[model samples]
Each structure stands twice: as structure tokens, then as C-alpha cells.
Target: MRRSFAFKCTLLVIGWLLVAIAAVQIPARTFWPAAFVALTLPVALGLNLAAALYWLLRNWRVAALPALVAVLTWPHFQRGLAVHPLHLAGAAPKATAGQRVRVLSANVRIFNVYPQLREKDPASPDKMIRWVASNPADVICLQEFYNEPRPSRHDGRLFQSVDRIGEQTGRQVFLSRTLTNSIGAEFGMAIFSRFPIVRRGTITFDKLTQNHAMFADLRLPSGDTIRVFNFHLQSMSMDEKDIVDSYSSKAGLKAKGLGLLRRFKRGMVARSVQMDTLMRRFEKSPYPLLLCADLNDLPYSYSYDQLADHFQNAWATVGTGVGSTYNGALPFVRIDNQFVGPQWVVDDFRVHYEVPYSDHFPTTAEYRLK
Candidate 1:
């Protein structure tokens, strides 16, 4: 009798977790705004589904509650694990009659030029240049990209990576530096395009650490002008040592966890403000807009919802499967995305997992004006 009572208590606890998980889809900034709590929703959904299966094996009636919650919250599951019939057709064709353009977005993470991974392979820089040259994206958006005026040759000549990619691909490159020195050396986001850039500008966020969004107006061969915004939002900014030390002891765990949570909260709040700043400018744009970004937030969060509310996500229309874009230790989350205006029809979208140069897998999409 006592064992059965304990089982009931455990089941009750699982059910409440499922409800909280489902409730996170609420479209608001402050209501249930904690990232730690929001991050558990995916895990809770998995546990709930497992419990539903277990209960069904014992008695069909006992499984209904968990099963129903999972079913009712099906949209969230669909977002993370979708399969489409269009995969057999492959990516959309490149521009032949000047109607379609292929765009690629990637956060290169400073070309992996840190001290710890110095010995791994210096070939990553060349690999990226060759990949972009061979793959041939018409427009490329890069974030967390680095540049140095007189970087040591040992640092892999990342100072000229932007110009190298442009020369290799025969595209025009424009950069927006979030960090700069007095000697005209800097690091920031960049946009490269085959089409002619008519104008360029940067949108600076007041409270962000080292991130900014920049826009370029390109004149296509068809004479259409479109504005492309490449943005890297605020990141959690947790170091590798922070993660390793967190698990070393109970005190360390508590301290590190709190520190990470504080960072997460700050990142989310800052991203919200930055997104609002972008949207206001986006509204005033004279041409059709395309947004390529490393949002550092999940699809269910307020940050994503607000940005996606008006724009159409390229992956949702053309991508198959979960389309996970992050290549970090936690593998399933997709924080990088490409969003287009309604005037474009997304013919194909894909996450390039083959490129293992950075913590993020590059995402590419082909679209034509509707």
C-alpha cells in the first residue's frame, strides 16, 4: 500500500511539471520569464511522454492525463521534431532568371582562434573560405567574426578573413565592428553579397556588451532593392571553466549555477531591448527586409516570438526535421535563424551540419520573390 501511495505522489509531481512546461508557450515577456525555468520545458515534455507510455502499459485510463497534455501542446513538439515531404526535392535552384537568391548565415565564433584549441587545426580558416567559395551563396551573413589590423601569422591571419572570403567568392563585403581599437583593428559582424550594395548602416544597442545589428541595401540585377539585417544578439557568455568548476563541488555547483542564471537573465532582457530597437527601425525601412541572426534564444521564448510575429521563418517553410543549428555540447537547440518578408517564397532551407568549424552549424536558404 505504501509503495502504491509513493507511486501516486511521483505521478502527481510529473503531471504538474508537464503543465508548467506547456504554460511556457504563453506569448509574453515577464510572465514566466526565467530562462532556467523555460529551458526545462523540453526535458519535462520528454519525461511526460515517457510517463504516459508507462502508464498506458499498466492501465489505459491512468495514461490519459499526461498523454492529453502532450497532445494538446503538440505545436511545441512539432517545432523541434518535424519531418517534411519536400526533402526529396532538395534545395531550391540558384538564380538563373534573376528571381531567386541563396543566402547563408553563420556565427564563426572568431574562427576558433583561441588558446586552448590552437593545436587542434589551423586549417579551419582556410576550410571556411574554400567552403564558401565552392558552395557559392549569393549573400552571406556572419556574426562573432574577428579581424585584427596586424594579427600575428600564428593567429592564422584571421585579420584578412573577410577580404579573403570576398576575393575568393567575388562578392562585396561590408563589416560592422562592435569592438574596435585606436589602430583601426576591430571585430564584429559582416555581410557579403554578389549584388551591389547601395547603402549600409549599423544599429547599435545601448546596453549590449559586444553585439550589434547592421543593414545593407542591395540592388539586385532585377532592379529590386532589399535590406538585409545581420544581427548577433546578447549571449549567455559562460566560460568553459565556469561549466567545469560547477560540477566539482556542492558549493561550486550552487555558485556557478547562480552565476550562469544571472547571465542568462541579463542576456534575455538585453536581447529583448535590442530586438525592440531593431523592430522600430525595421518598420521604417523602405525596402523588403530579410533578417539573419544568432538570437541565442529558443523558438518558444518571447524574444523569438516577437521577432517572428511579422516575419516568416525560412526553416518553418522549407526545412525538414528539427533543423538544429547549434553544434555545441547541447546539440538539439536551434538559436540561429533566417527570417524573410512575406514578399519572398522560401524554396529551400537547410542546416549545414557538415561544417564543423564553429560551435554553430551554418544555415542557408534559397528564396524567390513572390
Candidate 2:
């Protein structure tokens, strides 16, 4: 009788966790607490699964609670991690007109403008820029991109990335300078294309924030046009040092924890507004969209699901492992992502873990337009 009572308690607990996990899909606008649910999702899922196994033989009734939640959320779990490592595909098909196109997306963190980020390696910045220029990908979308156009105003003129990369790769560059330094260096998101850019523009989320999205319509060599959106969503602005300080005996946990929670709440609200704007564009797009973004939120977040549920998450379709992209955050967090429209076929996708020049790793994907 005691064993049966314990089993019932376990089922009740698992059911509540499953409900919270499901709440992550609710927009932060509707329910702010939903934003924080992503952080708890992994723990909830693990405990639920463990309980299901623990009760499998002892009580099939208790096991059913977790079993149902597991099956129901299987689609989200599959996209979050590619459990089958060896089963992922290899080798992108050769470039065939507009059918096969390779693209690269990254948040280069101002190319280590603050050398401290790269441990003061001056050459790391130049190396990063050159590596990107040399990549054979047909399209390159970058966030937190910095460039200097004129040599007369600033010493940074020599590092005019847009011109240097364009000259090296022979790709048409379309960029929006969202922020400018007092000395003349410009910072913004950019899209470099091997094909002609027939139209280009920027979507401004606010007058002050550096975060924004840009789109370019590229006319492929085969004459088909596709719209590509490069997005940098509201950053969580989470500093690793603060995360440490929160646990430090020297500091009060209540004070630090509240500070972190405030920022979390702000970011959650801001991202929802931004996503609503992006979704409007997504619905009205005239051509197929290849979305490349530095979401600054984990895959478990609501924004990630909203986009992934609508478009094809390239990684979920053909990637391997946990697909982590953030350098400062936890290991399992994947904030950088690429999603394609229905007409596109993802051939190969990669999280460039070897290139550790910034806080975020780069991602590449090869797609074929049907």
C-alpha cells in the first residue's frame, strides 16, 4: 500500500512538470513566466524520464504519465539534439546553378575589436576576417559585423572588411551600418552574396538598439531569386562573471539573483515584440526565406520554437550532437541557428566549433532550392 501511494505521488509530480514544459510555447507577452520555463525544461524532462523507468515494472499506471509526455514532446526534443550521431549526412552536393547553394552565418563579435575577448591576440581578428572571406560558401550572413569604409578618418580604414571581403570573394556586399564609432568605425549586420543583389534593406527594431535584421533578394546565376534574412535578436546580455558572483559567498544570493531575473524578464519581453515584427515579414515575404540568426536564447526558448515550428531548422533535419553555439553560456545552449523555407532542401549543416574567435561560434549550411 505504501509503494502504491509513493507511485501516485510521483505521477502527480511528473504531470505538473510536463505541463510547465508545455507552457514554454506560450509567448512571453501572454505569460512572462513562460520565458523562464526553457531553463527548467531539461531538468523536468530528465526527472520525468527517470520516474517513468523507475515505475515501469512496479506500477504501469505511474509510468504512463511520463511516457505520454515523452511521446508528445518528442518532436521538440529531436530538434534540440540529434541523438543519432553516426546517422547524420555528410558531403554537400556540388554547386548546380541555383539548385545547390552553400551559406555561412556567424556573429563575429566585432571581430575581436576589444582584443581582450581573444586574449589580446591582434592577429586573431585579421585571421577571422580572412578565414570568412576564403570560405567557399555562396552566401555569408554575419551579425555584430564591424567595418570602416574611409581611410582618412580612422586607422581602422585599412580593415574595411566589406571592401576586403568583397574584393577577395568577388561577392556583392549589402550592409546596414547600425552603429558608428566616434572615430568612424561602423557596426551592423551584413549579407555577402555571390549572386547579384537586386534589392536590399534593413528592419530596425528600435532607434537605439544595435540588434536588427536585414534582407537581400539575390538573383542567382540561374536567374531564380530568393530572399535571405539576417537577424540578431535581443541579446540576453548575460555576463558569465555575474553568474559566478551570484553563487559567491562574498555576495548575497538574493540581490544577485534578483538582478539576473530582472534582465531575464526584460529580454523575454523584448524578444517577443521583435519576433512579432519578424513573423509579419515572414508571412508577407514574396520569395523563399533563408533565415540566419543569433537568437541569444537557448533552443528550448519560445522564440526558437516559433521559428523552428514554422520553418525547417537545418540542424534538426541533418545535424549531429547537441549543436551548441554559445561560448560564454552553458555547453548545451545553441543560440545560433539557420532555418529555411519549405522550398529549400538542406544538404549539410555545421556548427564551426573550431573557430573560437568570438563569444558565438559560426554555422554553415548547404541548401538546394526546389
Candidate 3:
């Protein structure tokens, strides 16, 4: 009887987790609590997989339950893991002309503008800035981009990174600066393209932080034009210290925990609203779309689904192995993404884990207009 009772309880827990997993598909706009549940999807999925393995050993019939759900939601599973662990660098075939545009997207943490962030490889000229300028991607979308047109009192340098990258790559640039300082330091989202940009525009959020997006229409050499939207969404702003303290601190555990919870919820709700606005404007885009974003939300969230609903997520479509792009205290999280419209094809996608110059490792994808 005890054995039977234990089995029944396990089944109940499994069913509850399955329901919660499904519940996360609901928009945070409609049900705010779903946001928190979405955050648990990764853990829930891990447990569900474990339970399935347990049942397979003990009771083959019961194992079918989780197995069926896993198969049905296989696409969602692809968000985090691809069975095949492909190479991240120096493996893919080179792009051919007239049919391909290799794109790179990164936050770059303002190219480690502050001196302390350059601890990884400290030098006179920031190596991160130099790397970006020398990058060969046809199109590059950067967030938290910083440009100091002249030598500044703050940093004691001339960080004309924006112009330098544009000149180095021979790419036309469109920067949507959200903040400008007295020292001529400009920070914003930027899109650099080898193709001529015929048009450009910006989308500012409602009473929010400096997070924003910019769209550029580039005319390819093959006489094709595509709109590329580069955006950085609402960040949780959870610093390394905040995350470390939440678990390691002995004093005021309850208060620290609550603060973290509130921050998470606020970020989710903010992203939901931003996503709704983004979709409303970009859905009816005049040309084929290629969206590169630092979504600041997880793949399990409604914000992710909002964009994935219309576009093909490059990671889910072609990425292999771990999909994390963030390289900070929360290393496993993948908030950076590249999405393409129905007519676009993703040939190769990679998160550059080898590069550790910033908070976010760069994501690159080779796309073709189909």
C-alpha cells in the first residue's frame, strides 16, 4: 500500500508540473503569475525528464506519459538544447555571394567602456572595441553601444568606436542614441551594414529606461531589400553582486529574496509590454524582416513566444548544444537572439562562448533571402 501511495503522489507531482509548463504559454499581460511560472520551466523540464527516466526503469507504462509530452513540445525543448553539439567557430562553410548575409549581434556592455570591465584583457586600447571593428560580418547589430567622438575627460581617450567600426568594416551605420553625455559620449543601439541603408527609424518605449530599438532598410547587391530590426529590451538589471548576495548572504535573507522577486516580476511585465509594442509596429513591415535582439527574457517566457510566433528563431532552427549568450553571474541564460521572417533561411547560428570581453557573448547567424 505504501509503495502504491508513493507512486500515486509522484504521478500527481508530474501532472502538476506538466500543467504549469503549459500555463507559461499564456501571456504575462493576461496573467502576471505566469511570468514566474515561466521562469521555472527549465527546472520543471529537467525534473520531468528525470521522472520519465525513473518510470522507464520501474514502470514502462507510466513512462509514456512524460515521453508523449516531451515529443509534443519538442520544439520548445530545442530552445535550450540541440541533440547535436556543432562547432561554434571555424567550422561552417564560408558564405557565398549575392545570396547570403552573415550577421553578428551583441550587447558588448558598451565595449567595456569603464576601465574596471576591461579586467579580462587590460590594455591601452580596449580589445573588445578593436575586435568589433575588425569583425568581418556583413551586418552587425550592437546594443549598449558607446561612442565618444573626441578625447574625453572621463575616460581620457577618443572612443570613436561607432565611426571606427563603420570605417573599418566599410559598412554604412545607423545609430539610435538613447543617451548623450556632456563629454560627447553617446550610447545606444546601432546597426552597421555593408549594403546601402535606404531608410531607418527608431522605436522608443513608453516611460521606460534607455532600452530601445532601431530598424534599417538595407538594399542588397542582388537588388533585394530587407528590414533589419535591432533591439535591446527591458533588462532585470540584476547585477553580479545582487545575484551573489541573494544566496550567500546570511543577514536579511527574507528582504533580499523579496527584492529579487520584485525585480524579476517587474522585468517580465515590462518586457511583455515592450514586446506587444514591438510586434504591433514590426509585424506589418514593408519588407522581409531580420530581427536581432537582446530580449532580456528567457525562451520560456511570453515575450519570447511573441516574436517566435512570427519569426524563425535562429537558435531553435540551426543552433547546437547549449544556447546561452549571457556571460555573467547567470551564465546559462540566453537572452540574445536572431529571428528571421518566413522567407529567410538560417544556414548557421553560433553563440561565441570563446569571447569573454563583455557581459554578453556575441551571436552570429548566416541568413539567406529565399
Q: Candidate 2: minimum summed lDDT over ten consecutive residues — where?
A: 86-95
List lDDT for all candidates, in order: 0.75, 0.81, 0.80
Shift in Å, residue 282, candidate 3: 2.6
TM-score (C-alpha) between model 3 and the true structure: 0.90
lDDT of 1 by residue, 1-370 (tens): 8547745854765766655554444433354355455566666667778778877887677778778877886655555565456553654453344378889999988776565543566777668756765667889999987666565556545556666777656889898877776655667888999999899998888743458889999998888999999998878687757866788788888889888767767777777777778889989999988899998888756667666668878776666677888776664688999998888877778898889888789988888876
Instruction: Single out the weakest 10-residue window by summed lDDT for candidate 3.
Output: 83-92
Question: By descending lDDT, how would the candidates be arranged?
Answer: 2, 3, 1
- Looking at model 2, the pairs that clash are none
What TM-score, over all chains together, does every model reach?
A: 0.79, 0.90, 0.90
Q: Candidate 3's residue-wise lDDT over 133-220, tens digit each?
A: 7777899999888888786665555478876889666989998888888766888889999999999999988852458888999999
List the candidates ranked by TM-score, beginning with the highest. 2, 3, 1
Global Cα RMSD, each model: 4.5, 2.8, 2.8
Best candidate, lDDT: 2
Off by over 4 Å in 1: 1-37, 43-75, 88-98, 148-158, 182-184, 207-209, 244-252
The CA-based lDDT of model 1 is what? 0.75
